[model samples]
Target chain A: MSCNVDDSDEIFDDDDDDCSMEVCTKDSHHSGPSNMPESCYVKLTADDIVKEQRKLIQNVVELTKLPGHTARQLLQEMKWSFENVAVLYYDDQDKLFAKAGISVNGEAIDAVAVRGSSGSFVLDQQTITCQVCLEDFEREEAEKGMSTASGCGHVFCNACWVRHITTQVKEGQAARISCAGETFVEGKRRRCNIILDECFVEELLRGSGGSAEILKKYQTRLIDSYVNNNPTIKWCPATDCTNAIRVTDSFDPSSFDTSVECSDGHVWCFNCLDEPHAPAECSNVKEWRKKCQEDSATSNWLVAYTKDCPNCKVAINKDGGCNHM
Target chain B: MDLKRLKKESVELQEPIEKCGVTASPIKEDLSHWKGYILGPDDTAYAGGKFEIDIVLTSSYPFEPPKMKFNTKIWHPNVSSQTGAICLDILKKEWSPALTIKTALISVQALLAAPEPDDPQDAVVAQEYKSSIEKFKATAKLWTERYAKEGSMESIQPLLDMGFSEEQAKDALLEARGDVQAAVEKLLSGA
Candidate 1:
């Protein structure tokens, strides 16, 4: 049998004249029953064609109702060699028919086909099946699963969908998150909320391996804040003393560092190299020193009352005027 | 289920079409059908040939297998001799929604690398595949040389010239390791 090139062109572009010419000739070839087989044509026009299509669709529904394997096998057989496939389905035991137009061997014909009973169509309802398992609503409630990409209505169970998303994210290829059978706009589709969804999930449950470092940094920030805001901190200035710092306003040289009483009867500041002690505390020591000079009887008592000089590490002795001592 | 979410997902699906190397462009007027082409597999008898194929995307694309039919002439055991129907499961039962145009192209390339003998689209090729391994490989090579080679359309004339049965000439060319001249001579001697 010769294939008219023009008929092939009709498959891709319907408007070209040269192809239409060949199509015209091919049509004429089909019109003559004198050259064609009788088995090729069954007389059912208009109403009969619709009835036959409904019958075929009903057959598909019956086969789909059998089992999974049976449904799939029935689906595979839906294709016809000729044009025009009519699909019929049983709705409430009443048959509804839809016809598919096809071009077979350069001949435009109608083939009757059906989307097996396994497929469900409700008014205003669009349902998708999982491509992996080829299952629709039987696994769980429809509300619980994630639907496939746009234009394609395949759905996956939530757990399966999450796992798929996670794997894609981990691979650094999360941009592709389409359903198995859906086709998207070429050059226009972009990956969106999938990345955001992944981020939220990652926040909810810390991942196994790499997140420990982030957690550690957060803990360190907490520690730094606590220490800076604490109330008690003081710094000891003496070179020989342990560095004990407290967060307080009171300044006690004896508590902080070594202290010294000057020859002029004042407490000396070692840090500033100046005299800034309380005037009462400073002059009283001087007065006490003079009183010790006048009375030899006060010597032992003075020694018992006065503490050692913190700067020089020497005991106070009134007998020696409390300086070299 | 939300409209916004649906719109966002559709935007994501268009990405692969740009990256797929194959020209699988759908007419702007109708998005369901597309035309694509693949270069012949290299380092084989079918080098330098270009093959055209039609891709029909259903509403369930990415989730269901897209229908693929060859628009160009090809001679392969895994593709139907008459209808150019392919026997790959990725296009049918084993279809995954995650597969992209780029991946599908790679799959087609891989199909060329390894044709499935167990599930041959053409039964005669399947028989040849089962009974004689050497004959099958040689015949496949011959078919490629004759049908898929660049400017290989010349191979058709020799069989017709020598009045050799097209099938036998193809087998002989395969048996002769795709040596066109030798295949022609064999046909001439038989005549």
Candidate 2:
């Protein structure tokens, strides 16, 4: 759904049934102000996020006729916008694939044919050396020990590939882990820019007997990238809360009643992600908060909690709650 | 995994490569800490000087770029004079696993020859390099002679023979930035 503020009133009128009952109750509870605009949002649990991501990926896959992983890459590149992915797939198929770094119709495989011819070699009938580790493996052992990503033919031993993938994933770069093999261009060797697809990463990790913890971490990073890249959704700012709020209608930042509540009863301004302040604008609230922190916060606490000595006129705080003194 | 790749790279670096005079070796038995040496490129202000670099590799060696900074102080637009921090693309965001220590040091050597003043780490040096090319070359050459070149202590002996204390002579020489005539004039003026 588009979040254009001008058409939000009309859209809300036409789809009043789509608003959840919890949002309706929240509107009634916050009926103290007349100028506040009604806002609609849904609280998404952890399972809901996973389900929503899968549903969106499935829609893109069906519409574009691309594989699930490629569809996911396109969605991520497009910031989880199904409409944009569908439209771009029909309008400019090659541009969309190239932008998302997906090889079109196995064309990248063909380009690697010339580059890989010199990088890998067969040594007699017994052994071949892996370029990365510089180790010789038996011919039969090389076949099972070697692995290559989908888009490129530059092969490395399974151990090296696993190490590279795990390191990238550990560093929170799982979203765009590129191939480790270097390509020769104009007699100068440089890194290949082809990204390792998700399917290839998962398969390599599983086939190489990688631990489950690394796979879990990699998947978590992918999910985090999805939420972070999309603008319409934000994780609830409350500590230890895994729930997120997805705004269903257009949100106007100028209006002050953009407060949203999570499943844990934590209320926050959707615009600034701070505590809800109904009358004040977000910028004014930020200025007032900064002013308090800079000028009056400590002195205000002293004034409220301390008493002045009669003779010395020094401010003294009473630590114990004893009435006799 | 990192140890194996580092071991191989360390062994390969032992063989002297021609044309690029950059060498690095582990500081101790631990392969993670290394000391690098780069000979200043010819036909530049930094010529005939040797620059030392301190390199520290993390546990993820090739997958992550090694952190390198100059141990020897040289005046350049892209290197911090106070902290020895270097600003280079290959050392940061553009780093790839294909780049080795020798290649990174070679890039550093090339940075000395051709500096990108517009994108600078030291603003004063960049401004000097931009505003006056001749003055920048003179100061850079003086700094190279005072700091990077060996036998620099012997160059300060002439000022000591003129009745200036050793500390005073060294301070004046540094304040003059290795200009012999300027150091002599400042010592004579007693300012």
TM-score of each: 0.32, 0.73
What is the clash count for each candidate, in the order shown?
38, 0
lDDT score for residue B118 of model 1: 71
User: lDDT winner among the candidates?
Assistant: 2
Model 2 bad stretches (over 4 Å): A1-40, A55-66, A82-132, A182-191, A263-265, A287-325, B17-19, B151-181
Query: lDDT of all the models against the reference?
Result: 0.42, 0.71
Q: Please tell me which predicted candidate would have the highest TM-score against the true structure.
A: 2
Cα lDDT of model 2 by residue, B73-179, tens digit: 88899998877888886676556565678877887888898898988888888889999999899878877876788755445889878888866776678788777
Instruction: State model 1's lDDT.
Output: 0.42
Best by DockQ: 2
TM-score of 1: 0.32
Which tens-of-lDDT digit does each residue in A1-325 have in candidate 2? 0112334223223333433324433435654322334456767777667667767877786787765667888898899999999889889988887677664223231132223222232323466556667677787777667655555566677777777889888877777777766544333334555567776677677767676888888888887777777888888888889888887756666665888777677788877788888788886885576557766877677668887674334668875311222
**What does the lDDT read for residue B152 in candidate 2?**
52
Error of 1 at A239 (Å): 99
